[model samples]
Target: MHLIDLRTLQQFVRVAESESISRAAQALHISASPLSRTILNLEARIGFALFDRVGRSLRLNNAGRELLVNARALLRDNERLMLDLQRRAGGTGGTVVLGHMPGALYNGIIPDTARRVQAAHPSIRFQFESALESEQLEELRRGRFDLAVQTQDVSDPALASRVFASERYVLLMPRDHPLATTAEISLNALVEAEWVVTPERAGPSLRSAFTAACRRQGFEPRVACVAGDIVSALALVAHGFGLCVAQESLVRFSGEQILVRALPLLEMQTVYRIVWRVDGLTPAATRFLEALAAPSKAATPRGQRKR
Candidate 1:
């Protein structure tokens, strides 16, 4: 529905990327003046000044920076549309890009999830990347990635998610700690213990939750180490460096020295979910999600599972 021409948009992108009209013109095999005119024409069409020009030097203004993202997305979608057409005409397999946080790969969760999806849709292949939640959401919005699988949710209305699994958080520590032998322990008892938790930027507000739980127990957690991910946090715990609170799902990666214990007082839970843009999903993405949507066996009751 946009009125701007693709050619003009491409020219604007080239100029914006090069930061010089002459350079972009040379790269595009055209004279600088016409290329500059194309940019002006685009600005006119969009009704905004995209660049700040001072004595032949060009810098992207705020409007330009904002437009650049959408422009690049348009160009990318155009490329993807062509590929889609070609793939459809040939009756071949399609590709979907998946973004996830780090812990998924550590315990082989993402692969297991993909295999579960692939069981029903064998023709759809997946590509994966580990990225921050913000970056994952941005790329998913931009059509760079088709879906995101993470433990955290964002407030953006354009994105939607389905719960894949919910795993209760547990404390990870070496086997020989004094309270480690205890069947149950509270956060207050561990307040004096050194702990390892993920930094805020890496994933969810895990450390914040842990700290809040500690505060409710009348003290803040002593974070001896801030790990980049749950895997590294567990690794630190295995080496007897400190205790770590992690998801029960991570028990798959636990070593002989590592013990997973439920924390009654932290009162935390994490859900692994599949997130996608609610609009404009490609066939591959939709099909993969539909496969994932198939119902699973009923969950066992906590009382029965323990027995």
Candidate 2:
């Protein structure tokens, strides 16, 4: 059977509402003859009569009532879909799904930049997913995320990235720990200290880099606890579990419970970057990227020593 057009469906609904073909046509500003033919064509396409003829008017049958309900719902959904598409095309609205490391939230760039974007385009929205660097990169490659914020250098030709900010790694310790009094500690000095670190499976970049840095200093880091992310690692440090090396931006989360110290000796810095598929950014995503590139008064945490 041929599909019934939307115009026919509309006319059918108006006729069903007025219970008179002549009255519905008058309301629609069309002649009664064409309206009657449109309704007849709809019934023929669907292989059923929609109305029962009374002496001078029509009453909707059960099939007509069901069609009216479903048609109205479909039309509403279609209208919403069109509006959303138009907004996106005009760069005024849409949702951007972001995959990021926990540090992104602490760094101030993601939250800071997002706030600015929303201030300009209130209709644009964001969805955030925090995971390990490796997991975030994998999800980004699979197209589950529109953009990602991470530290690892992405060399894949299919992806493009930009460095938005950089932060050095800092040592976090219990406020009363012996080394906490030191202004800057050397990596060699902490050879005997127990460390809280992220395991390779959770995120290999930080772990492998820290391990290499430790090896260069002539000793391997003695792991006391393994946490899934930097936030958890810092929590372990606060409870005297062990020392943790993390991005300086995370000092804000340490509150007054822990002491943060600079590791000038280690010279480790993680560069934060925004990455996306070379070809897949939506207009909304592009607008967000532009906001990130624009300079703003909100500053990302940098070289923070103690909190």
Candidate 3:
């Protein structure tokens, strides 16, 4: 029987991503000769040339593209299987995979609920991933993530969501900022300020909302920088980089250097929801969901600041 080794598949995928065997080898900390030999062996076993040599570059053929997709799926399955086996061997309760939107941790509700579940079920394993709402939704649909937490509404009928927590939005800026002196900053007043926002991968929902709010104030927002997450965006604001809209719970980080101001005209409420598929859930996920159903207190999760 012919079989593909996980290691070989790994190298193949790495090469496919890097588009160069040498670069893949360097990234994997291995020699190029062996890596090239492994790819050739894989091509032979698969009865097709996976790569076409274009001068010095290795370009994926149609077969290679298809194989890469299946390879990734197989690797994900292998990882999940290995983790399940490890959990069983360790006498653990079970494993729960959770994904949440960027800056969901800033409000502390998701992590707090997670902590409660972990405390009650010490034997169970909890896997957490922080990503954009779109990424979380895609992963949830793919069965990669068991649950997701985000402020945006999930439009899919297959997924079910309920309000988990709510917080008002506040403008965050440097204490020395001209607008910091105001008791409450108006949306129109912020038209001229450079804004820092989360990266595009964070989804367009919030950005669109901010834009609409600005437009309603008769001016387009001037974005200065795009950060990886709301936390990072707020950090940039704290360092006098630009301004960001933060949740009311984030006020604890002001520290006399950053200022928090409410916007009455653009009063925005952040509504967080715990989303999961309508299909069956593992006992561990069910328990976690049950715990998460309650009105989450603003308790900070472990390793998170009280924001």
Top candidate, metric TM-score: 2
lDDT of 3 by residue, 26-57 (tens): 99999999999999999889788999998768
Ranking by lDDT: 2, 3, 1
lDDT of each: 0.76, 0.83, 0.78
Task: Report the C-alpha lDDT of model 1 over 1-307, residue by residue, as the tens digit.
Answer: 4588788888989999999999999999999999978888778877889999987778999999998999999999999889767764443347789998766554444565567656765666789998877788889999899899777666789988877766677777888877778766754568778888888654466776677777777887787888877778878888887898876656766777887776777778767788998896777677667656655442211211110
* Candidate 2: clashing pairs of residues: none
- Our tally of clashes for model 2 stands at 0
How many residue pairs in model 1 have overlapping backbones? 0
Please list the residue runs of candidate 2 whose C-alpha ends up more than 4 Å from where it truly belongs after superposition: 1-3, 26-29, 44-48, 52-56, 61-63, 131-138, 183-188, 202-204, 302-307
Write out the backbone clash pairs for model 3: none
Worst 10 residues of 3 by lDDT: 298-307
lDDT for each residue of candidate 2 in 14-72, tens digit (9 for 90 to 100): 99899998899899999999988888878887889989999769998999889999888
Q: After superposition, how far is residue 242 of candidate 3 from its true place, in Å?
A: 3.1
